[model samples]
Target: MNWGPPRTAHVTMTFDPEGLTRTQREGDACVACHKKWPRPRTRIGRLPDGTALFACPECADALLPQQDDTRSRPQRVAFF
Candidate 1:
């Protein structure tokens, strides 16, 4: 199966022991988009520490950090 360009949403995925065991016994799991894209086999991406990022290329791109951090700021207290 091949996944050319990712086209799904970004989602954080924790490694499941059963899933790992299954893949070890067999091989990489077939992604739903495999039939859509016939190249670049769209598999999961892992972080340096082995965290899995289960999302398509497009979704991944959208997940990139944005310039704005104001929305995450704590409420300001008014001083007398």
Candidate 2:
């Protein structure tokens, strides 16, 4: 994987063994690694079984980039 610049949190954050936990309410385990911690609203997606994917910044950073087609190169579209 070429891997481009990071666009998410936890790329630099050291992994907390227990990870971060939800402060608002109960939540599902992280979809990528099943770690029970996600930012207040980082909704990943739904599983084939229809389960919601909630992930911490670390898991998000790790999984999201691999899914991104553009790795080393800069993105072409400007969001701002």
Candidate 3:
């Protein structure tokens, strides 16, 4: 089986500005959950005109696959 990383170009994804709210477009709210407090800092993608997209850590994890948790950690082996 292929346990390889997800193939989605999540960070470089291009979003449609028309679908986003004014706060999201202005970087004031999360692009995923639309949360305003503790402003989302993780860059997920950009709009057609080059506007950066942001999402909360929780939402970001759901939207994109995590690399560090799966690839960097060594797998444990069982002994009989």
Candidate 4:
């Protein structure tokens, strides 16, 4: 079994001023649920194509093959 991290590249996501919450960012969408949220909940993960994966909490769960609950969400993640 390959219980390891995926190899991907760095990418960036920028939210508009209004995209700060779940009731402000218009037209925001969740890639997993395919539903529109005022602001999409996202976590930074790696994609197969060497890019960052922007996904909702639920999607993040499915993205990872293994389930690891030990690591809680970071208070503030700054990706540069």
Taken over the whole model, the C-alpha lDDT of each candidate is 0.38, 0.45, 0.79, 0.44
Order of models, best lDDT first: 3, 2, 4, 1
Ten contiguous residues with the weakest lDDT in model 2: 8-17
Candidate 4: residue pairs that collide:
none
* TM-score to true structure, per model: 0.24, 0.36, 0.69, 0.32
Which of candidates 1 and 2 is the stronger one according to lDDT? Answer: 2
lDDT of 4 by residue, 9-36 (tens): 1333443432233422322555456455
Model 3 lDDT on a 0 to 1 scale: 0.79
* CA error at residue 15 for candidate 4, angstroms: 19
Model 4 residue 55 lDDT score: 52
Candidate 2 stretches with Cα past 4 Å from truth are: 1-27, 37-41, 66-80
Please state the error at residue 39 of candidate 3 in Å. Answer: 0.5
Task: State which candidate, 1 or 4, has the greater TM-score.
Answer: 4
Question: Tens-digit lDDT track for model 2 on 1-80?
Answer: 63532343333223333343443123456644556543423554443444344556766655554544465886597686
Provide the lDDT at 73 for model 1: 68
Q: Of the candidates shown, which would achieve the greatest lDDT relative to the real structure?
A: 3
After TM-score superposition, the amount by which residue 75's alpha carbon in candidate 2 deviates from its true location, in angstroms, is 19
Pitting candidate 1 against candidate 3, the one with the higher lDDT is 3
In terms of lDDT, the poorest run of 10 residues in model 4 is: 18-27
